[model samples]
Target: MTKCEISIKMMNSTTPSPSLGYLTAHQLENLVKEHHRSGWKSLHMEEAFHLFNKMLTAKPKPSIFTFNLLLIAISRMRNKQHYPTLLSFFNQMHQAGGINTDTHTYNILIDCCCRMNQVNMGFCVFSGMLKRGWSPNTVTFNTLIRGLCSKVDITDAIHLFEIMPKVGCTPNLITYNTLIKGLCDSQNTSLALEWHKKMVAQGIQLKPDLITYSTIIDGLCKEGATEKALELVQEMIDKRIAPNVFTYNTIINGFCRKGDIQSAFKLFEEMNEISITPDIVTFNTIINGCCKVGSFDKVSQTFKEMLARGLTPSVFTYSSMIDALCKGGAMDKAYEIFQQMVDTGIEPDSITYTSLIHGHSILGQWKKAFELFKEMVDRGLAPNTITYTAIMSSLCKEGKSSEVI
Candidate 1:
């Protein structure tokens, strides 16, 4: 018995002078009908099928509406703990004159299965939908596409997209967006852009929504195609699709990553001119860019501006600042900021510790650097290869070749 069943049985036993009878077939049908007519919010599966024997032996079997209603209730079930109840409910519904396998119905099941990460079951349902001679619609294709995409099956998703037209379902914007995101996530930026162009050539007007623009720009940045990313931003603007916060952040971060702090600051000024209020991510990107170029004064100014603009600095902000201070040979200042980070409740992680140790090692402060290294290990932070190499290189520069090995 399911937990719900056990709970219902326990509740029944605790009632005074409990009505000790199971629901008759007639009562079951009537209760199901009542629940269906009045919105299925209150139908308990345990009560509906208490007398499983009589329900299965009913003279005129339950209708399809009865089973579908049960399925909807099953879908509303939020917890996996109700899976047994649901499986039993589906089994009984199938046995009770319910054609429990249709395209729409299977789509719902596939969605639930995908959300639960039961990919095999979802595929099984898809096969069942095909074998039943039910033509899968665009919505069905979209659901499966999304499911495959969620599992990072970009190749399968693209295959499904290509097959949609053959299946008499033309791809829509949602389908394109799904496939584009999948391709972008896999760093297949060129292919993703090719599809975007195809989308436009097929007379699908490109609006360059946040996700669409962000994906392409991010892909270009990862490939160091910052110039192309900037051009696309202009293309989006020329197409009259207003750039949102994500769009600006992507461009700013791209410039920052390329160490082009001047262009990043220029974009910041442009953002303000466009009446786009900067968010914390915007500040973090500019601050990070300044830090990369060793422009501590500019970093400080941006940090102050970020605070004055009522934006809260995130962990990235603190990380970048600590990294910048350390890079500028200001270990004392870096440690002071590290203490302030703890004062403000931001816990330091491996990257933060690595930055400080790397700075001291570079300056030949072997004792201080090793102390931080031991402290890092004691605090359960494992230094990565970069941290080890930094220390080894420092020791080698001081002719400590034996220790370097």
Candidate 2:
């Protein structure tokens, strides 16, 4: 039989094929429902496909909802490599021609398409949904908008946002948040603010949520409008929205980038006051900020506090501390920290080695610097241009220019 003939036979088959194993449509649905309820973990792809084949050849075919459940499970697999497997299975179901596709089915397809970087295919699926007389819901619009945004097609995303109301679907908080993120990601924060204003003015009882505020704040911070971002944080609190750790981190990072370590510390204290524990990222940002300002004392204090709070120092934490000590002309202390980092099994990067080498070279300790360079190479870490320049410059300054070659 040809492919079409086999599909027709599969669609029309009443009795379950013995080769596919016997399972009633209702039993297969229960299996799928259980898998869905368990967070899509109980069913493997092969087992799901086996059940699907059994359902197809059963006396009564399963409902589209059941099929959608299986497809959702496949789509949501943690390993995204299963996305194409889902698309292929969807094609097989479509070719069989027994069950009609629904809006949820198309939405799943659209999401898979977008995730696969096939945004154009997602739009095609959207168009097909429309042609099938399926009214595109808010979820449909949100998914498409996100797809357009992921491709950096902000203009089209904005156009779609404008027409959402025309399709009898009002934009919700998710819709507003998605569009705002898109605008911000495209470096158009000014337009994002306008959308924020319009969302507030709509008076549809639709208020900007934490995500809405955070996205705009992050955009402003990226633009060096950190003071404005801080004002937004106040607005969030005034509106009875508690700023989470992520919100605080974004603002703190902004202050650090601006060299406003004092302001960053103030926010760090505020987080403690609000019962929001400062995470490792919070400590790292503060330590790095102190390093930049040459406030080695503050770095030491903060590093101790971070340990007191039971947070393990990351590689960045050690590197920043080591670099700061080296710059402070405290070679012994820097070496002590380096040894501590090694004892803790935190492998040093080229930055760490370069900092120590540069510090030793500054003191005209060329032998120690050379030993460090050799050790760095033995560790399979390549010395960068900064490393070479530090050694060569020190040799020239010591009137040992001949040894530089």
Candidate 3:
């Protein structure tokens, strides 16, 4: 379909002026062209539908060719809400002397229905298409399977997938990816793996993308199978599939959670050596790992090293440092770093202030701690439960329970 046949315009309903008299198809074509050139493709479904209705109603006993334009117009809309509108529009067009529905028209409607989460309507369209002797294509089956997978009804998705070959419809990469993602989301890792294996066995020439590997790795990590996650990472490397930043971060985080700080550090170094530069998350994980083991000195040193490497420390980095310092009774130094944070153009967020408050309170500086609390409130920073707990405990230590309450 040409752009001229799919122009969309927004009508000004407030201006009730001269009625548009009878319009020929030629005039409608010209108007569509005029709108199309003026960036009509960017209009949303609502705006386009309103304009299209005006064009259709102007012509009495509009041709089925007019409905074809409407179909393409709705496809340009690319939104699910327009599916029913398209269906109703086509029905009305045929009732008003429109031509018979063709295979192309039904395919367009089915595709739109599937996209809009109305897979049942797509099925209805499919049945209609079949009754009219219109054969289903690969696009039709993929759309339905994808729609079912999107709703997480894996049973229906698998059933649709199985029937595709019966109808001579070959599943593509998108079909595999959609089903794989659904299985991964449902935590059916074994089935997801089986599907992946089947795809390979079929000589599908599959390229396991980052999402595919990450989903499996993350699932294994959550199931307390860190070894399996690591093994997958190694396998991805062996398969020449370079891991992305997220993949490295996931494994690093998993290692940290398992208290294997050494493994996490090794991965961090290996990531950089492989030209996968560490992001803020990578540094934060290692810093947090050191903090968990009460390795304050290592945490401080690592913070400096990260800064020296020109990595702008994020809020989490500073907060982790404050946490490690306070836990190690280095409140004075922690306060110094807190001041540097504000001076370095990185605005101290609530976490930054809370950590300093906790540090001062632990050092028996109740007045200083309270002043910081007031500053936090004045600066519009909300103190969380942890901040309140730290301050209250410090107050109780100074025999100021009544004042604290």
- The lDDT leader among the candidates is 2
Query: Which residues of candidate 2, in runs, are more than 4 Å off?
Result: 1-20, 327-329, 357-405
Top candidate on TM-score is 2
- 98-141, model 2: which lDDT tens digit per residue? 88889999999889878887788788778878898888889998
lDDT for model 1: 0.73
User: What's the TM-score of every candidate structure?
Assistant: 0.74, 0.86, 0.67
Model 1 lDDT tens row, 95-183: 55634446666666666666666655667767767887888888778877887877788888888888998989877778888788878
The regions of model 3 sitting more than 4 angstroms off are 1-156, 204-207, 327-329, 353-374, 382-405
What's the lDDT for all of these models? 0.73, 0.85, 0.74
Candidate 1 ranges beyond 4 A from true positions: 1-99, 113-121, 150-155, 204-210, 378-382, 388-405
In model 1, how large is the Cα lDDT of residue 297?
A: 92
Model 3 accuracy (lDDT, Cα):
0.74
Taking the tens digit of each residue's C-alpha lDDT, what string does model 3 give over 1-405?
001222223233443224344557667666555555664565556555655566556645344455565577667767665666777666655555535667667777777776877777678778868987888877777777777777788898899889988988888777787788778777877788888778667663666666778877876766667788888889888978889888888888888788787888888889879899888788888898888787767677778878887899877877777777876778877778777777787788888888878887778888777888888888999999978987887777888857654
Q: How far is candidate 3 from the true structure (C-alpha RMSD, Å)?
A: 7.4
Steric clash pairs (candidate 1) = none
Model 3 TM-score relative to the real fold = 0.67
